[model samples]
Target chain A: MKATREAYGETLVELGREHPEIVVLDADLSSSTMTSKFAKEFPERFFNFGIAEANMMGAAAGLARSGKVPFASTFAVFASGRAYDQVRQSIAYPGFNVKIAASHGGLTVGPDGASHQALEDVALMRVIPGMTVIVPADAEETRQVVRWAAAHDGPVYIRLGRSPVPDVFPQGAKIQPGKASVVKDAKGRGFGEMRPEGERDGLDADVAILANGIMVSKCLEAWEILTAEGIKSVVVDVAFVKPLDEKTLIELAERCGAFVTAEEHSVIGGLGGAVTEFLSENRPCPVVRVGVRDRFGQSGTPEELLVEYGLTPGHVAEAARKAVRLKWAV
Target chain B: MCREVRKNVLIMIGTAGSGHPGGSLSCVEIISTLYFGVMRVKPEDPNWPDRDRFVLSKGHAAPTLYAVLAEKGFFSKDLLPTLRKFGSPLQGHPDAKKTPGVEVSTGSLGQGLSMAVGMALAGKLDRKTYRVWALLGDGECQEGQVWEAAMAASHYKLDNLAAFIDFNGLQIDGRVEEIMNPSPLADKWRAFGWRVLEVDGHDVEALLEAASYASESLGAPTAIIARTVKGKGVSFMEGQREWHGKAPKGEELSRALQEVAKS
Candidate 1:
C-alpha cells in the first residue's frame, strides 16, 4: 500500500543508477514530491530549487536540452498552474526531453484542499500538443510509468498522488503508453446484464467503467457490486490520459457502447472529459462522467473527500446504472 | 562586430515587414560580443557537447540572434530574410529545434534565465567547463520567474552562468520606468548574490570584458547590466518607445538601413 509518490522516488533512484543523465529538480517540495530519496541517493544529480516552480521548470528545459533527462517534481497544482507558461514555452513548444513528475494530484490530496489539489492537471497537460500526460492507477503502475517516462525522449507529465492507494495491477504488470489495461473482464456472469431483447446494440459489454488514479480501486469495488447484482461489467484502468489509449477506447466504445468514466478530478476536463471527447468524435454513445462536478475540494480525510467528491464505489455504480439506462438513438 | 550584426538585424527586420526592430536592435552589441568574440561555439557543429550555451530570454530580440547566428555561419545568410515567415527555421522567436545554434526555445520572457540556470547546473553535475549565457530585457525583469531564476542561480552558486540585462530604457507601452519600473537593477542583482557588472552596451570591448570577467568569477553567477539604447544606430527610432515593436516602413526602411550602415 505504498503511495505513488513513494514509488516515484524509488523508481527515480533506480533510473538514476541506470541512466546517469537523468537529473531530478524540485521546488522545495522534495519531501512531499518524494524526490528527496533521489536527492539522498544522488546529491549531485538532484537540485533543490527552493520554492520557485517557474524557475525550476525553466531550468528543467535547459537541462533536457543539454543532453540530460530532467524530472522536475512539485505539487500538481503549482506545477500545472504557477509554471504553466514555463512548461508550455520552454518544454512543450521545443519538445525537450523533460519529465515533470508532479505529486499530490486530485481529491486524494485531502487536507491540502482545492488550493493544492490538481484536478485539472490531466486536462491542462493533455491539451498541450505532443505533451504526454500519465495518471498511474497505483504504486506498481506509477513505477512502470516513471520508467517509461525516463526512456521516452520528449516532454511528459506524470501526475502522482500523496496518499497511499490500493494495488490494482500485479507485481510485474508492464504499462505501455496510451494503452488501457483491463484488470477486470466480465466472463462468468449471467445474461441479466445483457440489453433488453430488441434494444440490443450488438455491443460486447453491457457497461464499461473507465477510471484512473485512486478511483480505479473504487471502480473495481463497483464492478463487484454490479457482479453481485448479475450485471456483467468491465473495469478498464486508463492511466494514460493524453494519447488516451484511443484504439482501446474506440474498441470499448464499439463493444460496451455505454461507459461510466470515473476519476478523482474535475468532471469538466479529466478522465471523464477525455473519454467523452474521444467517443463523441469517433463513436458517439452515452457517457456518465463520475467526478468532482464543478466544485472545489475542501479539507477532509482522503476517504471523506472521495465520498464527498462523488468518487466512491456507490457513485461509480450509480453512474454505471445511469449510463446503462440511457437510450442513445442509433 | 556589433555594428555589423546590428546592420544585418536592421536589414532582416526591415525586410520581414513586421518585427521588433527596437528591442532587437538594442542588444545587438551584447549578442554580437558573445557570439563573435566571447562565446565558445562551433558553427560547424551547433550541438557540440562542450559548447557554451546562449539563450535569448527576451525573445522579441530574435532578429539580433538570428542575424548573429547567420553571421557566424551557423546557417545560410539567406535564411535571415525568411524570419517570421511560414515554415521558416528562423522563427519569430528562437526555436532551438528549428535553428541550428539556438540552445533552447525561448520567446516567452523570464524563462531563459531559468534555462540558463539548468544548463549551469548540468555543467556542474557533469563537471564540464562550459558556461551558460542568457540575455534579458529590462522590462522582462518584471516577470516573477526572472527573480525566481535569480534566486535559484545564486542559491546553487552557479559560477558558470552569466545573465545580461539590456538596460534599454524603452518598452512598448512607454519608458520602462513609466510602464513598470525595474530600476536599481544592479543592486537587486547584488542582493541576489550576483557579481554585478555595468557596461556601455554599444562598446564591444566593454561587453567582451564583462563577459570574460563573468566567466572567471567563482562561487556565484554574474549579472552584466548593459546600458543600451532602444532602436540604437538609427537616429529617428532611437529612444522612441513606438519602435519597440514596429518595423521600419518604405522610406523609413531605406533611412534606417542607411543609418545602420554608418558607425
Candidate 2:
C-alpha cells in the first residue's frame, strides 16, 4: 500500500484531540498542507494566517510562550526560506515547542516549480541550533514523526513530500527522534535469515543505500533490482536528518564498502551532505549522491520531474552500481 | 508617576551611553499613563495570571518599559544604573525572561505586534478578560510583517488587543518619510480592518482617553496612532535623527538632566 504525506494530517488531528495544549496554525494553504481537516474539527485551536508565513512563525512562537504547543504549517519553501529569520529568532532561538510541519518538501512539489520546491530546507533548518529535522519516508512514517514532534520538547521541522510513496515500513512503526531506522538489510537471505557473521556487520555488502522521505521507496526498489544481479546492498532510512544517527551511520559506513545517498532535495547540503560530512571523519567511504543537481525545477507532473531529474529507482540502481565500481577500482 | 518615568528614562539612557533616547523619551507619557493610570495590574504579582499583558513592541525603547516596571514596584528604581551594563537584567532590549513585567522579548522590528496578537488570542481561548497591549514604532511600520499582524488581528477579531504606533516620525537613518514613508498610517490600519484612533502621544489625558475607548470598543482590534515628537521633553535631542540611537555623553548628560529636571 502507498501513502501520501498528507496522511500526517490525520495523525495531527488525532494528536490535537488527545492534547488540549496542541494548537494548529496554517498559512492559507491548509488544504495543501493537509491541516484543513484539523482546522475543520477544532476551529478554536486552529488558526489560518492566510498566506502570511512570517507572521505565522512569530505567532506560533508566541503561542509557545503562552504554554500552547503550536504546530505551524506551510510549504517547506516558505517555512524555511520565506520566514527563515522568524524561525531562527522567535522559534529556534527561544527553544520553543513549535512544530514546523511543512509539506511539499523537495523537488516532489513538482508542477509548482522551483520557487515552491524547497530543496535546501533540510540543510537550512538542520544548521540551526537545537532544531530537530525529521524526514519521514512515507505516509505512515510521516504520521509517526508528527506524533513524535508533538510529544518532543523544543523546536522540530518535519519534512513531508506531496506525492504518495510505498509503505516500506510496517504500520505503527515506532520512531525515535535522532535515530535512523534500518528498514532493509540487503544481505539477509530471503528476508528472514540473518546474514553470515562477517556480512552481518555490513562491510561485506558491496554498497549501502541511504535515503529519506520518498526516496527511501526508490532505494528499496533499487535494492531488489541490484540483489538479482548479485550485487549485495544494505538499505537504511535516515528518518532523522539532524542530530543524525551517527552511531548507525558510522557502523554502516565502516562495514559497507561504499555508500549511495538519495533524497528528493538538492544534492548539495542535505542528506547527502550530512552523510558525507559524517563519514569523512568517522569512516571514509566512496559516496555517490543522487538528488537535484543544484538547478531550479520547472512545472511538470511529479512523475515527469522525478524521471527528468533522475530520482527514480533506476537512477538509484545506476548510482549504486557506480558507487560499487568506484569502491572496487579504488 | 510621569515625572518619575521621565527621570528614570533620562537616568537610564544617560548611564547606558548607547541606548535609543529619542524613542524612549517619546514613549514616556504613554508608558507612564498605562502603568500609573490605565492598566489593572499588581505591582507585587508581576506575572499574576489575570494581569493584563503589555509588550514593548518597539523594544529599542527598553528604558521606558524598565522605568515603568520599576515605578510600578516590580523592582527598585535604584537599579536604573545597571541599564546596558555587563550581566545586568537591564539589557539594551527588553527580555521577558530577564525583566519583570516585560511580557515578551522584543528588539527585532515588526515581531512584537504579532506576539501580542497571539497573547490576545490565548486570552480568548482561556476565556480570560485580560487585554494585550503592544507599542510599535512608526518607523518599524515599514516592515511588511507589521501589516501581516494587522490583518491577522482583524481576521481573528482580537478586540482584546490594542496596538499603539509611536508616530515619532524618526528612525536611525533620518525622517521616516525620507527613509521609508509610512504616512497615511491611520488609514492603512483602517484598510486592514482595525478601528484606528489618532491621539497626541505626549498628552496623558488624551492617551488615557483613547486607551479607554479601545478597551470599550468591541468586534475588532484597535490601533491608536499616537503622534509624538521624537525626543520629546529634551530640547537638544528633540526631532533629531542623531539622537535616535545615541545616548548622552558626560557634559551632554548633565545638560539633558538639567532640561529634564525643569520638565
Candidate 3:
C-alpha cells in the first residue's frame, strides 16, 4: 500500500529527469506533500516558497506563462482555500499550464483535523473555468494522472490524500483523460478480467458504485458486500471530476438506473455533486451520495475518522441498497 | 510621447464612461518609461520568447497599459474605444489571454508581483537576459500576497526583476493613509530584502535612470517607490479621492484632454 502523494513525489522526479521544462514549487510543506523528494533530486528545478501558498500559486502561473510546466504542491486546504484567488486569477483565468498537486485531501488527512482537511477542494477547482480536476484512486493511477498532467497544456488540480491506500489499478494501466475506469463489471469481473466493450454493453447491474480517491477500494469492498446479498454491482472509478466521464456515466445510468457516488470528500461538490449535477441535466437518475455530510473533520486515526464520517464500506453498501430502492420507487 | 500617452489614457477612460482614471493617470510616466525607454519588447511579436515582460499588477490602471501598448503598436489604436465593453479584448481588468502584449492576467491586487517573480525565475532557469517589470499601486501593498511575493523574489535573488509602486496616496474610499496605511514604503521593501529606490513617479528621465540601475543589480530585486499624485495631469482631479474610480464627463473630458495635451 502506498499513498497517492508518494506516487506524486516519485513521478515528479521522473518527470523532472525527462522534461527540463518541468519545475516544482512547494510552500514549506514540501516534506509533508512529498515534493521534497523532487527537491532533493533536482535542487535547481525545485523552489520552496516557505509557507506562502498564494505566492507559490502565482509564481507557478508565471513559470507556466514563461513556457515551463510548473507543479505547485501544498496541503489541499492551503492550495484550494488559502490561495484560491491566486489559483483563480493567475492560473485558471489565464488557463496557464500549471499543475496544482494538492496533498492531504479529505477526512483521512489524520490528526490535523478540520482546519487541514479539504472537503470542498474539488468543488472550488471544478467550478473554475478551464480547470481540470482529478482525484486518482491509488498509486498507479496517480502515476498515470501525473504523467498525463505534465503532457497536457492547461491548468489542472490533482487532489491527493495523506494515508496509504490499497492499489486498485493494475500496473501498465493507462489513464484516458475525461474517462472513468470500470474496476468491476456487472458479472463481478474485476478490472483485470473485464470483458471488452461490446460484450459488457449487454450486462445490466443493480447499482453503479461510482467512486474516486481512497474510497474506490472501499467501493470494491462494498461491491463484495452487495454481491453476497445477491445484488449485481458495477464499480467505477471516476478519476476526472471536472471533465467528468459523461459517456461512461450515461451508459452506467442506462444500465443500472441507479448510482451510489462514493468519495472521501464532501457530498456537496466532490464526485457526488459532479455526478448528480451532470445526471440531473442529462440522464436524471437516482444517486445516493456517501461522504462527509457537511461536517468538519476531527483529530483521529484514519480508520476512526472514516467511521466517524460514515465513509466505511458498510456505509457505501447501505447507500447502494438505498439507491436501488430509490430507483425502484422512481 | 508622454503627452500622447496621457491624452490616450484620458480618451479611453473618458470613452469607457467607467474606469479608474486617477490611478491610470498616476502610473502613466512609469508605464511610458518602461515601454518606451527601458524594456526590450517586440510589439509585433507579443509572444517573442526572449522579449522582456511587463505585468500591470495594479490592473485597475489598465487604461494606461492599453494606451501605451496601442501607442507602441502592439495592437491597433482602434481597439482603445472598446475598453470595458462587452466582447472587447480590453476587459475591466487586465486579461493576458484577451489582450495582446499583456504578460499575465492581473487585477485582484498584490498577485502580479508573484507572477513577475515567477517570470524572473524562469528567465534565470533558461539563462535568458530578459528582465521582468511589474507596476503596482501603493494601495495594493496592503494585501499580504504582495509581501509574500516580495519575500520570495528576494529569497530567489531575482536581480532580473524590478517593481514600481505607483505611490498614489488615494484609493476608492478615502486617503490611503486614513484607510489602511502602507507607509514607510521604501523601508518596508528593504526589510523584505529588496533594494529600494525612491523617485518622483511622474519624472520620465528619473524613472528611466532608476530602471537602468535596477537592471544592473546583481543579487536582489529592486523596488522603486514612485511618489505620485492620484490624478496627476488634470487640475480638478489631481489628488482627488473621488476621481479614483470615476471617469470624466463631456466638459470634464475636454478640460482633462487640454490639460494632458499641454507640454
Candidate 4:
C-alpha cells in the first residue's frame, strides 16, 4: 500500500530532474503534501509559499504564463476553498499551464474532519471553462497522471489522498487521459476476465460499477461479492472527471442495463453527478450513487469514516444490487 | 503622453458606451510613465525574455493600460476604439493572451500582486535582471489575498518587483475609507515589510523617479502609494463618486475631452 501523495512527490522529483522549467510551490504544507521531497532535491526550483495558498495559486499562474511549468501543491481544502478566486481568475480564466496537485482529498483526511476534506473540489474545478480535474485511484495511477498533467499545457487540478490505498495497477502502467480503465471485467467470464468486443456488444450485464479515487478498490471488492452472488458485473476506474470517457461509458451503458457510481467524494457533483448527466442524456440507465450524501463529515479514523459514510465494499455491493433491481423493476 | 493616454481613455470608454472612466482617468500618469519611460519593454516583442513585466491588477482600468500600450506602439491605436467590443482584442479586462504587452490577466482584485511576485521569483531563479510591476487600486487592497501576496513577496525577498496602489480615495460605493476602510494604509504595508513610497500620482516626473528607485531597491518589494484624484484632468467629474463607473455622455464627453485636451 502507498499514498498517492507520496507518488506525487516521487513523480515531481523525477520530473524535476528531466524538466528544468518545472517549478514547485507549496503553501507551508510541504511535509504533509510531500512536496518537501522535491524541495529537498531541487532547492532552487522549489518555493516555500509560507501558508499563502492564494499567492501560491496566482504565482503558479504567473510562472506558467512566463514560460515556466509550475506545480503548486497544498491541502485539498486550502487549494480549492481558500484560493478558489485565484484559481478561477489567474489560472482557469486565462487557461494557464499550471498543475495543482492537491493532497488530503475526501473523507479519508480522517481526524481532520470535513474542514480539511474537499468534497466539492471536482465539481468546483470541472465547472470552470478550461480546467481538467483528475482524481487518481492509487499510487501507480497518481504517478502516471502527474507526468501527464506536467506534459499537458493547460490548467489541471489533481486530487490526491493522505492515507495509503492498495495498488490497482502494475509497474509503469500508462494512464490514458479521458479514458476509463477496466480494472476487473466480470461481464461473462468469472473474476479478472474481460468479455470480447463482440460478446460485449450483446451483453446486458447484471450491473456496471463506475468508480474513481480510492473507492475504485472498494468497487473491485464489491464486484467480487456480487459475482459470488451469481451476478455478472463490470468495474471501471475513471481518473479524469472532465473530458469524461464517453466512448467507454457508452459501451458500459450498452453492456449493463443498470449503473452504480462509487466515489470517496460527495454524491453531489462528483463521479456520480458526471455519470448521471451523461447517461440521462444518452443511455438513460438507472444509476445508484454510492458516496457521502448531502452532508459534512466528522472526525474519525479513516477506516471507520469509510464505513460510516457508506463507502465500504458492503455499501458498494448494496448500491449495485439496488441499481440492478430498480432497472428490472422498471 | 499622459494627456494622450487620457484622451484615449475618454474615447475608449466613451466609444464602448459603458466603462469605469473615473478610475481609468485617475491612473493615467502612473500607466503613462511606466509604459513610456519607466519599464524596460520592447513594444514589438511582448514576450521578450529579459524584458520588464507590467501587470494591471486593477483591471477595470484597462483603458489606461490599453491606451499606454498603444501609445508605446505595442499594438495599433486602431484597436483602442474596439474596447469591450465583440471579437475585439481589447477586452473589458486586461487579458495577457489577447493583448500584446499585458504581462498577466488581472481583473479580480488582489491577484495581480501575487502574479508579479511569481514573475519576480522566476526571474531570481533564472538569474534575470528584468523587473516586474503590478498596478493595484486603493480599494483592491481590501482583498485578503493582497496581504497574502504581500507576505509572500517580502518572505521571498523579491526586490525585483514593484507595486503601485492608485490611491484615488474613492470606489464604486463611496469613499474607500467609509466602505470597508483599510486605514493606516502606509503603516500597514510597511508592517507587511514593503518599502513604501508616497507620491503624487498625477506628477509624471515624481512617479518616474519613485518607480526608478523601486527598481533598484534591494531585498524587499516596493509599494508606491500614489495619491490621485478620481476623474483627474476634468472639472465636473473630479472627486465625484457618481462618476466612479459612469462614462461621459455626448455633451459630457465633449466637455471632458476639451478640458483634458487643454492639459
Assess each prediction's global lDDT (C-alpha) against the native: 0.88, 0.86, 0.93, 0.89
Off by over 4 Å in 2: A1-4, A189-204, A281-286, A321-330, B2-17, B40-48, B73-91, B97-100
Clashing pairs in 2: A202-A255, A203-A255
Q: How well is each residue in B71-185 modelled by candidate 1, as lDDT tens digits?
A: 8999999888898889999888888889999888888888999999889888998899998999999999999989999999899999999999999998888988988998889
Q: Give a tens-digit lDDT track for model 3, residues A1-330.
A: 999999999999999999999999999999989999999999999999998999999999999999999999999999999999999999999999999999999989888888999999999999999999999999999999999999998999999999999999888775575699889887777777768658976348999999999999999999899999998899999999989988889988889999999999889988999999999999998999999999889989999999999999999999999999999998
For candidate 4, the per-residue lDDT at A187 reads 50
Give me the overall lDDT of model 2.
0.86
Candidate 3, A315: how far from true, in Å?
Answer: 0.5
Query: 2 or 3, which is superior by DockQ?
Result: 3
Best candidate according to TM-score:
3
lDDT, candidate 1, at B125: 85
Q: Score the docking of each candidate (DockQ).
A: 0.89, 0.53, 0.94, 0.79
Give the interface RMSD of each candidate.
Answer: 0.7, 1.5, 0.5, 0.9
Q: Candidate 3 docking category? A: high
Error of 1 at A83 (Å): 0.7
Q: Residues B1-263, candidate 4: write the lDDT tens digits.
A: 88888988999999999999889999999988887888789888889999999989999999999999999999999999999999999999988779899878888888999999889988998899999999999999999889999998898899999999999999999999999898889999899999999999999899989998898858999999999999999899899989988888899999999999998
TM-score, chain A, candidate 1 = 0.94
DockQ winner between candidates 2 and 4: 4
TM-score, cand. 3: 0.99
Model 3 pairs whose backbones collide: none
